[model samples]
Target: MEQSFPALPGQAALPGLRHRLSTRIVSLSLGALLIVLAMISGTLWLSWQLEGAGAAINDAGSLRMRANRVAIELARAHAGERHQLDAQITGMDATLARLRQGDPARPLFLPDDPGIRAQLERVSHDWNQRIKPSALADLGVATGEAPAYPAALAAFVDQVNRLVSMIEQENATKTTLLRLSQAGLAAMACMGTVAVIYLLYIWIILPVMRLQDGLQRMAAREFSLRLPVETRDEFGMLADGFNRMAGELEGLYQDLEARVAQKTAELARHNRDLAALYDMAALLNMPNDSEALCRGFLERVMQQFNADGGSVRMIDADHGQLHLVVSAGYSAALEEAEHCMRVDACFCGEAASESVVLIEDLSKGAALSAGRPASDARFGCAREGFPGLAVFRIETQRTVLGTFSLHFRQPLTLPASDIRLLETFGQHLGVALDHLHLSETARQLAVVEERNLVAQGLHDSIAQGLNYLNLQVQVLEDAVSRSDMDETRTIVPLLRCGVEESYQDVRELLLNFRSKLAHGELRQAVEDTVARFRRQSATELALAFNDAQGGPPLQPEQQLQVLFILQEALSNVRKHARAGHASVIVRNGRTFSMVVEDDGEGFDPMEPAADDQAHVGLHIMRERAARLSASLRIVAARGTGTRVELILPR
Candidate 1:
């Protein structure tokens, strides 16, 4: 038999905890208010009963006194003392009327009891019939025959005494009843107060204390604490809710701890992957031959994946063939036989053609190793003695570089994480190869451009000077052929001067080609050139550099070009422009500007004379400026000074 337990109180109660709590609070307050109101009503009723009893007692005493006074007045009148007998009679008459009408002033308090009314009626009758007549007679006003003298007084006193006794008895009874009612009400109110307090402690105060204790425990991270659910009320529902919340919080905290641990492990794994990739990149960047780089990369891959052997094979796009660049853990005969394969031949070739990773379980005896000639070479699976193989494509954005194949002795299954690592490694290798290729191409281009610049420089300076020297020699030859002695002598000195000038030009060209500014410091080079020009020329040179100490430094190539342009401008100024003041201003900012000005005999730049030596210098300066990716502007006139400006992007 399955034993069942009762459900916790108010676990699934309707209207929720808030509504139930409000209802309970309202009920308790109303109950307490009703009890208080009942106590107040009981006290008021008792007071009213006591007040009526006191009034009745006082009326009884007054009735007795009035009766005694009537008796005294009757006695005095009988004794011939009738001075105030009439006044006494009137007073007694009024009291009798009040008793007969039951004191109409107290309407809700009528003396309607038969015994008391009868007694009061008798007193009134006696006073009117016997006492009044007797008193009137005594006062010397005869209306009727007077009755017996003290008999009427004795009857009236007896009746008044009876009425007083009845009134006292009623007062005593009411007093006792009022006292009992008060005691009963007080006792009931006290008992009710005790019951309400006990109930409040059970339903409200105890639950509240328990909730407070639970909250304190929760604040201390004791999420397992719970309140007891004892009744189908607000407190019980609250306990249920609190227990549920604690359970959920405990579960969530445990789950959070688990997730944090899992994520930490994942992060550690990722860090190891990154460290390995960084090591591979450093190895690839070293100045090693292609075969050495491949060999090192294969070793790392084998170590990273716990594989037995691996090979890096590159695709010859033009030949449509796969050439094994490097290999590991293979016999010499097998390596020679499998060193190269066609693009569509085997698993590696398939990976290259499809540009996807390929896996093969050689233990299944698949056809991947087919079509190979049977020989002692033992190519493919037979040669490698590996049960499983994986081939990954090494590619970039659009170009397929090659294939990397790894062999495992046992049948291997790759997890997503390991597969992702392999893919990332392939990407890094492909990009590294591309960078090396680009670097080699750039080196070759740089060499070719340097050779072209040297050829042009020689043609512009040394070759031109030699041409002039040849013309001068031809003139000396013509003079000697004519036998003109004076002309011949004149031609000889001109020839000597021409030879010296050509030699100097050759020297200067060699110096210009060989000159290498220290670390390509354009400003220092400019200052040194200016000092040299000042020593060699009569012009006063002023150099100004504004905001040139900040901003990004220019590239080495750009700085060299700017230095060369400045040197050319100063050279033209020295040889042709006989200026007194020359200034060079270089400003470095978001853009670079170099201004070379001279106060000299300047010529129109737009239409320079064909024989002007400055023209060649200006052409060279413009060529250097073009290489700097800058624009050159020359402002010169016959009379005005010359200003050359070069603006380059920073």
Candidate 2:
């Protein structure tokens, strides 16, 4: 769930910033530097022009003095003064030429003014023509030979003075221009400095300050705050980025509570589903009959689904019928009427064939109002005032056991999650029902086996005793018919003994038949049998029992068989072996073992019995041991006690 930054209207249509901050600052600095350089260059040029003006004025004044000196030297000319006159004239001509050609190396050049140039030319001409000729005319002659030298020299001095004044005036003008240029340079420097500072603040510093303020606000969790995009620079992009981030954060914070609430609801529903599943599994594991298990399952399921009524119906496959095993929130008459239904009957039967069936608004009026073809076919649920019904198949992976129907008081539609949960519950019910069927089958098999054993016991003991009584009576009848009193008396005693023995056998059989392993407690049954045996024989009997910890306990059938074997062994010891002492030892360990021992004049266990009746108990004991999948051994020798030992399988 990534969202792009929202842009302002028409923002995308704008062009990028052409003159970035860096480019503008660099341009401003370079312009300021160029202005300063130009100002300094102008001032230096003015100073150079003014420099030569002062030297030109000094040269003009010297021309006036040199002219006067030449005139004096002429007036005083003698043969020795002739050389002095010539030298003065030559020095003046040199000065004139030097001024005319200006010395650039010495920075002595005339100003670029028309008036100053004319003055300099006049000075050079006067010195070279008028002063030089006048002075040279009388240089080699007598003193009187000089021609009006004093007057002419004075006129030439006046001309030189005028030239000096003009040079001074030009120098003054240049000096003024130099001073004004310096002032302008100072002003430009000050202005450039201020401009640079203001530009830097506007371009860099101001934006930076605004960005810092925005960050502080953001840090304070003010997500609604946004920075204005003043310029299209990097800082502008930063502002945009910050605004986008704030929008996203605000959006997330706004919906955070809603998302958390949704997650909490989902978690609560999940926990509830888990608890329901655990409770249902526990209910199925209970050791209850099919009817009770189904009844409890229906009641709990109805409560879970918030249904007004519900019923659990099992399929009687052989009869092609659905039998209602349990019902809740239903009228007694309705329960009785709907107790049994054919395979092709109503919603329950249909649900058995399918996985699920949901029927809403089953009322006759609503169905007819909806104009449905099956409107008139409204079933028992509609008549029973349960308009809404949901039927789920109770099924395993391999088979469908039956259907459980939930009846709603009002029209209802279940959500997918609820429907899924109901299906899971149906599978659980299917498994439980299957287990109940298996347990019932096993109980029936145990009953049949016990009945057969009882019949066998009756035929082996009581039946045999009855047959012997019949033979004895026949023999007595023969003796009585012959009028043989001696034979009759002997027969009569035998008959009483035979009848007494038969009665005793019948009682023993009855006792043995009634002996049951209550609650599958083998040890208790053994103790009771041993006590009965001791009382009957008036013999000293000891019973020892030991059960090791963590031993695998015997099943009910195995325990019952073991008890019967012990009973048979004790009976044999009491009736046949005239033993003074007998003991029954029982041990429960990795394998169960029971031994019944007596000290009596014992016979060989390997020898064949004289008749079937004599060894019937032993045969029966061996049969019971075989049924337990255990080992049975009879240890006996002459003049030693007999020991019957039974060891059951692990």
lDDT of 2 by residue, 289-369 (tens): 888899889988999989999988888889988899888888887888888877555442233344664444675344321
Predicted structure with the largest TM-score when compared to the true one: 2
Q: Once all C-alphas are superposed, what RMSD does model 1 give against the true structure?
A: 10.4
In the range 1-650, model 1's lDDT, one tens digit per residue, is: 32223555645544444346566777777887887787678767655654554555465556556656656776665566764656656766765665555442452232446888777777777777876676555555343546354456676667777887886677667667667867777787788779878978877899999999999999898987777777766677678889998888889888989999999989998998998889998998898766777788899999998998788889898998789898887768667887887766534323334443566566665423333222222236544687677777777886878878788888767776777788878887887777777888898987887666666556655676687778878887887888878998887787687677667656655655665754537767777778877876789999997755575767777777787788778877876788999999999888899999999999887784787444778777887888778999999999788999999976
lDDT accuracy of residue 290 in candidate 1: 68
Candidate 1: where are CA atoms >4 Å away?
1-19, 66-166, 169-209, 231-237, 331-337, 346-355, 360-385, 438-650
My TM-score estimates for the predictions, one after another, are 0.59, 0.72
Candidate-wise lDDT, in order:
0.73, 0.77
lDDT score for candidate 2 against the true structure: 0.77
